[model samples]
Target: MIRLDYPIVIEPAPEEEGGGYRARVPDLPGCISDGETRQEAVSNIQQAIMAWLAEARNLGWSVPSA
Candidate 1:
């Protein structure tokens, strides 16, 4: 069985620049998502990660070899 582990980091967007939420998966390079609400962003990123993993598996691509 192959198990993948990753860390997700979410932070609030600057209020001055219009409040929102931003999320990033540390283990996946260039994987980032933003949303107008924190919950929306988190949910979106979770799906994004799932899709990304699926694609990686389909293409036989190892995740960053980490």
Candidate 2:
């Protein structure tokens, strides 16, 4: 299993982006999560990271190393 401490960025969503907090892994393109609260957004991002890694593994993509 690939273990890495990838950087995570969480920011408040803009009005046009829908009001909520959004978390994203800067190193992983298209890996993003959003929620009503900071905690929710963070939790969702954790799941997103796992799913992203799983998909990458399934497709034989190289997992990024921190």
Candidate 3:
């Protein structure tokens, strides 16, 4: 199992973009997620972070630290 912590950037999603919230892990390029609420966005991003790490590991990519 691999565990890593990365800083997240959360911002309000644009109306045309679904009007929820967007969360992204800056340390992991292209790792992003969205949800209807801030808390939800955070939760979703946490899951996304795990998935990102898992994929990175499988692909033998370098994982960045927080």
Candidate 4:
């Protein structure tokens, strides 16, 4: 299996925003996920990365390297 690593930025949700975590992959443009905890956010982001790669492949889009 080809593994791709991308830098992710995880930010805390503002208190007004309900208090959770959000993770975003900068290289994947719009590839993001969120959850109620840091662990969940990271896990969700990993799933997002997989989905993003799959969609990119389906559309014949270029996949960037880590």
TM-score of each: 0.70, 0.86, 0.90, 0.91
In candidate 2, residue 42 scores what lDDT?
88
Model 1 is weakest, by summed lDDT over 10 consecutive residues, at 1-10
The lDDT per prediction is 0.77, 0.89, 0.88, 0.92
User: How far is 45's C-alpha from truth in model 3 (Å)?
Assistant: 0.4
- Residue by residue across 1-66, what tens digits does model 3's lDDT show? 555467889999999877999999888999999999999999999999899888988999987866
Model 1, 1-66: lDDT tens digits are 333456778999889867799888888766778789989888777777777777888999896643
Rank the models by lDDT, top first: 4, 2, 3, 1
* Model 2 per-residue lDDT tens digits across residues 1-66: 656478989999997988889999999889999999999998898889999998998999998986
Error in Å for residue 47 of model 1: 0.6
Per-prediction count of colliding residue pairs?
Answer: 0, 0, 0, 0
Q: Candidate 3's C-alpha lDDT?
A: 0.88
Instruction: State, as a TM-score between 0 and 1, how close model 1 is to the true structure.
Output: 0.70
- Sorted by TM-score (best first), the order is 4, 3, 2, 1
Q: Which prediction has more favorable lDDT, 2 or 3?
A: 2
